[model samples]
Every structure is written in structure tokens, then in C-alpha cells.
Target: MAKEVYQNRIELLQGTLDLLILETLRWGAQHGYGISHAIRARSGEVLQVETGSLYPALHRLERQKWIASQWRLTEQNQRAKFYELTTAGKEQLVRDRSKWEAMVQAIAGVLGPVPEPEA
Candidate 1:
């Protein structure tokens, strides 16, 4: 028997990742690992945010002042930097959410409703 190899071809575009990161921060402050874990969990493991990709995104959002970071001790008593959304970030989230909803609705309209299955 041959084993099947799975691949993920979707690469999040330049700013999309920042948007997702910001949305995650909307819940509250979280460290790098916490953010990645929450996203994966919330996505039901369908989306995996790699550390290499996540760290850079966090730094970029921080640079843009969309998110703020501070050092804090984790439950394990280890020091780590946690991030939270700024007021500007909350506004951005509202805008992004609207944009995403519109895009999804547009795509759904193109696809049309699914046909009913036979009883």
C-alpha cells in the first residue's frame, strides 16, 4: 500500500495574516504560542499557523501600532511577550470583518445555493 502525502498550498497573502492576528487579539492579550494555539483550536485544526510565519506577523502588527506587546510571566512562570489589540486595532477589526463578510457573500452568490439531497 502506498501512503498518501498531504500538502497545504494556500499561503496567506502579505496583509491577510496581520488581519487574522489582529482578530485573534480581539479576544484579549495572548503570547505567541497562545495565539497560534487559539487560532488552530478555533479553526478545528484546519488552519495551522507556523511559528516562523506567526512571529514576523506579530512584529509587523506591533510596528504598525495595531497591537501592543509587553513582557509577562506565563502560567509556567516563564517570561514571554504577550500582545493585545489597540483601539486602532479594534477599529481595523470592524473594517476587516465587514470586508470579509462581503467577500464571502460575493463568493457564495457566485456559487449559488446547494441543491437539496434526495430524501
Candidate 2:
């Protein structure tokens, strides 16, 4: 049962890593591992982003100029490529969040009759 829940969450997170990554960086710059760990932590361990997917997505986002990366030394004095959102990325994040929110609403509607929130 726990395995099933984890698997389902992984499936859901696959489609949202880009958005989640962007959102995580909104707090500040992070290296690849930090970013993935942050996502997992923020998602309450529901999302464990695999390196197989994460590195490619980071490269892709860097290519798109949605994010920029630079080498920096961590507190441990180890060099790492830290990624931070660009102005374009911030703009794109806003648009993407709106679209994501709309998608959630549409999916919820399809799922049917969620109880309305009290005002």
C-alpha cells in the first residue's frame, strides 16, 4: 500500500518536475541534488526526482534561458553548478502556475463533485 502510494506520487511528479524545480529555485539558487532534495522535502517526500530526469531537465531549462547556472563553492567548500531563475524564468513561472492551476481545476471537475470550501 505504501509502495503504491509512492509509485503514484512518482508518476504525478514526473509531469510536474519542471514546475516544481522552478518553484523551488524561487527561494534561491541550488545545485542539482539540492534542488531534487528540496522538491522531495517540500512535497513531503512524495516526490523523489531521479537524476535520470533531473539533469536533462536542468540542461533543458538552461538551454531555454529560463534558468541560468554558475559554479560556486558550497558551505562544504565543494564546487557545484548552482542554478537560479532568470527574469524570463520568473515570468514563465507565473504563466505556468496559472496554467497548472487551471489544469488542476479541470481535472478536479472531471473527478466530480469535490465538496465546496466554506467561505
Candidate 3:
């Protein structure tokens, strides 16, 4: 059987990833790869969370206090640092989610409904 190749072209805008990363932390503290997998799974494989992007975002969020990290052993027994959301992170998530929703709604209003083909 031929292996299926998945292409991920949806580029996440600057700072948008920070919001998603913070939200993912809300579930619980998770290591880098775990965070990537969680977002991909939650997004139903639509969003390809890349490690290159995710690591920097995680560090940025840590510096911003939206998340905090601590070194710990992974389920596989490897040492890794896990990140978790702080109180501020939760509050920020709510604000970000609202803003994103508004932006989406505004764009939808401008785009209008799709035209249906004649029967």
C-alpha cells in the first residue's frame, strides 16, 4: 500500500499560535511533542502544528507568563520540560477566543454566503 502524504499549508499568523498554545496548556501540563500532538488531534489534523513553530511559541509564552514550565520525566522515561497554563493564561485565552470569533464573524459578513448552483 502506498503511504499517504499529508500537506499542511494553513499558515498561522503571528501571535495566533501563542493563543492556541496557551489554550492547549489549559488541559494540563504537557511536553513539547505532547502539545504539538494535542493541537493536531484537537484540530482534526487540519492544523499542522510544527515543532519549529511550537517551541519558540512556548518559550515566548513562558516569558509572557501565559504559561510556566518545569522539567519532568515523560511517559517514555525521557527527561522533558512540561508547560502548564497560569491564571493569567486562562484569562488571556478567553479574551483571545472572543477576539478571534469576532474577527471570523466580521470576515464572514464581508464574504457573504456562498452561491448555490441552479438545480
In order, what is each prediction's RMSD in angstroms? 7.4, 6.9, 8.5
Candidate 3 worst ten-residue window by lDDT: 1-10
lDDT of 1 at 74: 97
Question: lDDT: which is higher, 1 or 2?
Answer: 2
Clashing pairs in 3: none
TM-score of 2: 0.82
Candidate 1 global CA lDDT score: 0.85
Summarize candidate 2's per-residue lDDT along 6-117 as a digit string, tens digits: 9978866644777988999999999999999999998899989999999988998898899999999998999999999999989888988997899899998889977889
For each candidate, how many residue pairs have backbone atoms clashing (under 3 Å)? 0, 0, 0
Question: Which lDDT value does model 1 have at 82?
Answer: 99
Instruction: Please identify model 3 stretches exceeding 4 Å from their true place.
Output: 1-12, 114-119
Writing each residue's lDDT as its tens digit, candidate 3 over 18-119 gives: 778888888899999998898899999988788888888888788889899999999999999999999988999999889888989989988998778899
Better of 1 and 3 by lDDT: 1
lDDT of 1 by residue, 1-119 (tens): 12222222223354567778888998999999999998899989988899999998899888888899999999999999999999988988888888778878989988998878999
Descending-lDDT candidate ranking: 2, 1, 3
- In model 1, what are the clashing residue pairs, if there are any? none
The candidate scoring highest on lDDT is 2
